[model samples]
Target: MSPGLQLLLHDASGEWSSAQYTFDQIAGLLMRRTTSKAQDETVAVAGLLGVDVARLLNETGQDARMRAFLLQVETVPAAMVLANAPARLSFPGFRWAPRSFGGIEEEFVRSAGVATCTADGLITRRELTILSFPKVFVSNSETSSPDRIYLHLPESGSLYAMPDLRKLGGEGVHEIDAVIIFPSAPETPLVARQPVVVVSTVNAAPGQDAEEPLECVYRFRAYLGNWSDRFRPSQMYPEMFDRPPGEVFITAQRWSRRVMIT
Candidate 1:
């Protein structure tokens, strides 16, 4: 428990009656006062606010205090969506967010950070840049890696690890159509070979008016290769020799009105 919070609670009816704490302040408290473990930090927040840790852990729904602590902060709270993430929240708007950051492993890659929350604690929407693949084949065990996913440029056979794909969907590799989205723009200047991180994917094409929302799966790092660099199968993948690379363009598109984190 934090001394500031303890004082605030102790003086709730006195000088601190109308006192308020910013998200930064609370988040700072969590980092400084609690251990590095995410579960302990979560529980410490709940305990400070008099919330039942057991209930918060057991129930997937959001707790009022916890929601306020998470969303009311100055900056947007981020939820890591990679495999082996420490914790995951079942709250309606936070389905794509990690429940706790206590035991996060090194494999965690990307997070769903672009989102807005309603005043009433509902997550209204999440925004991300999406790239849909016309052709995608799952990598096999022999070729696949626990920390990386081998990928060729559209029609090109060369492979690179710009956006590292570590522990994407756990240890197993599976087949599915990729609807890749970048949660945030690259830190560097926008260029032909822009950096892109995979946020979510869908097995089938959900038309613009499809009733069902896209369920967010795994996230990894990859790149939008420059069209000029023609990838040749002779370089890496002989099977891809027949398919010549095409001109790939980077455009902004809205793929999720609402997103689900799995």
Candidate 2:
């Protein structure tokens, strides 16, 4: 865990009394079951106290004194919501926003002979499997534009690696264990088959004058490997492409935009 989160957990453990008090303050924000009405008053009290009622109740491992304090805190209208309906007091559908590519335009292009390679099939299957796992955007940084992106892939499942073919390398012979295809443009194939190490350079869109400055563009490469693997495709080829978005980040944004329009 990061040092900041570790400190947070440590501080939470150290001040059991204060933490419990905070928890109770959160619980008080819930509505009373008997009245079947919202408890704006409790929420106001919690806000005035500058306590996060939701986080307090979610805290675990507090002492009996803390728990007792929670009971008193629950008397508040906001806290009543927890007393009446604990589940409702739980925060749901809360999530971090996906990082926007902004001026960057992503296009996938399939390489000419990637489909003919034997490893291509395995790579494609692995890509599909990785897509099934949850993804998270860890960080993004760049100058002309965000050139690097980090992602956390889930480790619940495993991925088998293809045999190394670098020793037998030849012109046009498969040098990478995996290949990623991109969406093709009008004259380009929908997929751009890229080796695990190949970095993509984002070129200006066709027909705009060279003198006209282009927006910041970043190209990223996605690699396939076991979740625990230390070498990420993006890290291996930083000079080439940026990084792929996490599966969850991509999915949430896609869903959110769809929902908003609908």
Candidate 3:
């Protein structure tokens, strides 16, 4: 261990840790001092997490930020957890599905470093574009609101907490890294909404043509935030930007109006 660096040790829960590493033993895989077993339990707990943790710490090579994060992660939750869900499947035939569902337009806007939606903004009726479900059947309602649409990324169509490549390139829509649902409102909200849900994806980049996803979907993440009407902010929602070429999207119905996107 370098005299400058003190190894950090903590459990997965980010609870119960030790940081008493001496200057001499800091240069090892898992630092343990002959003078005490203070780091023993920490090592056992972290060891159960797998060798990956050790590798990450080693690869990070004493990066203070990552080390701090690992030691006090409970205080600062990971911006995103790569695999949290064990059920949902990923995009099997992404582009072959409805192009309207893919948020390529949003991606194009974001890659340019522009905000697609926001905590607040004036979105003209057409500015907040929507599409039809290609089918019509909602209770006994005779009139279907043009703003009304149906979006379904079946579990089979969604890549949940797993590492599998799913093709997201096809005609019409160029690239799609993720599928999200925004709970806004029936009409253009003059204000903000509460409890925004976001899902971000890390899929293979587009292949030769737009039809192939060069890589398989390896990871994705989810986030929940306070009220918001503007496009997903990369700052507030790092998960939204931690993805491939495609960007974040809102695929569900808006559920609020004029509250405040705090």
Provide the overall lDDT of each model, using Cα atoms, as 2-decimal numbers: 0.40, 0.23, 0.24
Better of 1 and 2 by lDDT: 1
**TM-score top scorer:** 1
Clash pairs for candidate 1: 23-73, 38-102, 87-99, 88-99, 96-261, 156-231, 163-221, 163-222
- Writing each residue's lDDT as its tens digit, candidate 3 over 133-237 gives 122212212232111121322321211121111221111212223322232444432222111112222331222233321222222223323223233333233
Where is the poorest 10-residue window by lDDT in model 2? 253-262
Stretches > 4 Å off in candidate 2: 1-127, 130-141, 155-262
TM-score for all models, in order of appearance: 0.48, 0.15, 0.17
Name the weakest run of 10 consecutive residues (lDDT summed) in model 1.
244-253
Give the runs in model 1 whose Cα sits over 4 Å from its true position: 1-15, 18-39, 47-54, 57-96, 102-126, 134-140, 144-170, 183-207, 210-212, 219-258
Kindly indicate the candidate among 1 and 3 with the higher TM-score: 1
lDDT of 2 by residue, 35-103 (tens): 222232232334334434454344442222233223333322210110111111111110000011111
Candidate 1's displacement at residue 204, Å, is 4.4
Weakest 10 consecutive residues of candidate 3 by summed lDDT:
107-116
